[model samples]
Target: MDAIEKNLLKEVAELDSLPVGAYNIRANGQLAGRNTTANIDIVTKTDKPGIDIYIRPFTKNESVHIPVILSQTGLKDLVYNDFHIGEGADVTIIAGCGIHNCGGGNAEHDGIHTFWLAKNAKLRYVEKHYGEGDGRGKQIMNPTTIVHLAEGAEMEMETTQIAGVDDTIRKTGGDLAEGASLVVKEKIMTTGDQHAVTDFNVDLNGEGCSANIVSRSVAKDESKQEFISHINGNCACAGHSECDAIIMDHASVIASPALTANSVDASLIHEAAIGKIAGEQLIKLMTLGLTEKEAEDQIVNGFLK
Candidate 1:
């Protein structure tokens, strides 16, 4: 890997070098490196431009890193990565994409990730998206995620996209079985003339199934953002979704949340809040000797964290 790729990896995945466990690195739409352990296997799909990851049953305390980087001009890369986790396994998956386009042509990467967790399995997934370049063209990313949790399974997801991307559309959906649970937290920031949209849909179809989804975002300058979430409880299930955003300058934010309950015992809730930073928050920080910009940055940082 070159210095640019290394820097991008550090920014997106916080990796100083190749990880110690199972991993795969993709750059410029091709495989750059790969390693698999005895309990986990990574295989490339012959019919697609992505890999399939398999974790054996009863495996625990292991992790996998699959990060993609793009440095080419006028390049559009699309990949489909699927994960199959065995029963009773507990593991973590780190995946993200970074792009550097320094030309007049646009650069884009679209990734679709699907996960299947067996009974009693637990998974922790993290994904980050970033873009950087001094170019006239745009940096665009569209990511879609699908999850399926079996009975007694659980999955927790953390996703963030803080800066540099010019345009993005993110979509996530999940289905939970009996006694299954799903939790998702997302953070995003947009500045300049950038635009971002997020959509989340979750279904709790079995008794005792539950889901919670939350998103926090900041829009600054002339940027625009939209968030839509839908939670459906079919059978004695519980679901909740929330969206919180801060708008600044001429930026605009729209949040739409929907909840549906088909069973009498099902419970669902949706909440959304969008507004500018409180003047008192800035004044309090300023009294502590911080500049106005610094105070605003600190507040936004803490809110997202």
Candidate 2:
């Protein structure tokens, strides 16, 4: 492996040795690697960052993980991942993108993911984005996700963006059928002069369908972040969305959460709040012999965790 790939693998996957049933894709110019189980298949189209993943039916209690890394500097990469989860399946998906740039030009990664869950299926999807380097170039990431849930299907998606990304725009949407449910939790921490904008939308189109979304973020230094979430209930359904953020230094943030109900049996609600660390919490920790910096770190850790 080259030095850039090595750095990306270490910083992103946080492992020298890969785990069982793990699929790794190093997206420099095209789709370049793969390894997987019999129940799950991975295919890459002709020299593109687009990948198709198929999970066989009745593959209950199984888990699949795919980690994508971009180690090329002074370039732009567009990746599209399609996932098809079969009926009666219970699965957990761990997928994320990490980038390392060491050049002067711009380094950007745009990820587009679509998920299709069959009837009675349950899925827990987790994705985290991170970028790091000493280069003068900017590291920007744009992630777009769309999910479709069949009857009686349930999907819980969690997305996180750690430190070091310069700019990001995150967008996610969900469409739910009868007896279907979708839950999303997004966490982000931005430093320096980074900027992030996120938008989430959900349409509850079936009876007994439900959708819930929550966002947590911490902005430090001169960073700025904005979060917009909306949930629409077209049938007898329930929807909720909330945004919570911590603002530090000269950073700024905006949280806009809205919900609408068109059906008589629908119930929708939303809330948003932005604040900083309470001085009392820090003083309480200081009384336990921790320094101010240590106490601050502890609080950040707890909030993010």
Candidate 3:
């Protein structure tokens, strides 16, 4: 192996030896010094399951970027995983998981992620979770993500969840500091006999802090989806939250979006809607020579676009 490859393997071995809990990435040779910058790419073996990751700044003013990819081959249960982003540093992280297992057995996965954006820092995170059909009874996933922003810091987070075997529950939230801002967007799609729930909460704790949340979900067959979003302004902050869902063919959806402002100077607004696709649009597409299924698919594709 090359020098870099050997070093990386050594680091991974060291991390594997640590106890199961939160530990700084620096301890594993994944982090550079404070005020420096580093990039990390991770690809795990198929079906290995459990992994716990913690990211923290070695010193103030550091910057780090991480990209992670997961494959479904040899899939096993992922009991718990954690991600931590430290204060006073900028971090950009991208993560995605896909299941390609063809066996007919149930699976369960859970994850917890935390972000601490210090003063004058920033964080941008994007995550996609998807599962493939295996004719299994139940496949469950529960994920929770939390973010804390300090003065002048900002966070931008986006998530996409696509249904696979059975039921999935995902929860995410964050707190914004003075002059900080947070923007979150989520998209969910499900089919078959699946059940999914997504929850989001945002707190604006300092003056001039703001937040924006947008969520959309689509369910088909006997599937069910629920979306809940809340935005709270504790001091003098301003923000808005919007949620909408589309249901079809015996599918059901529930949407709840709320905005609360504790101080008079704070301004918050929220809106939520749940319904099916407009029949007129479908009919129009069908008249264009598309089959019923094709028209429906077109509408869904357009909605997500």
lDDT, ranked from best to worst? 1, 2, 3
lDDT of 1 by residue, 1-305 (tens): 88888988987889998998999999999999999999999999999899999999999999999999998979999999999999999999999999988999899999999999999999999999999988588899999999999999999999999988999999999999999999999999999999999999898987899999999999999999999988888999989888999999999999998898889999898888999999999999999999999999999999999
lDDT of each: 0.94, 0.85, 0.64
Clashing pairs in 1: none
Over 42-82, each residue of candidate 3 has an lDDT whose tens digit, in order, gives: 22224543333334553333333222212223334442333
lDDT of 1: 0.94
Alpha-carbon RMSD, each predicted model: 0.7, 1.7, 8.4
> Relative to the unseen true structure, what is the C-alpha lDDT of residue 75 in candidate 3, on a scale of 0 to 100?
39
State which candidate, 2 or 3, has the greater lDDT: 2
Best candidate according to TM-score = 1
lDDT score of residue 94 within candidate 1:
96
Q: Lowest summed-lDDT stretch of 10 residues in model 2? A: 10-19
> Which portions of model 2 miss their true places by more than 4 Å?
2-4, 46-48
TM-score of 1: 0.99
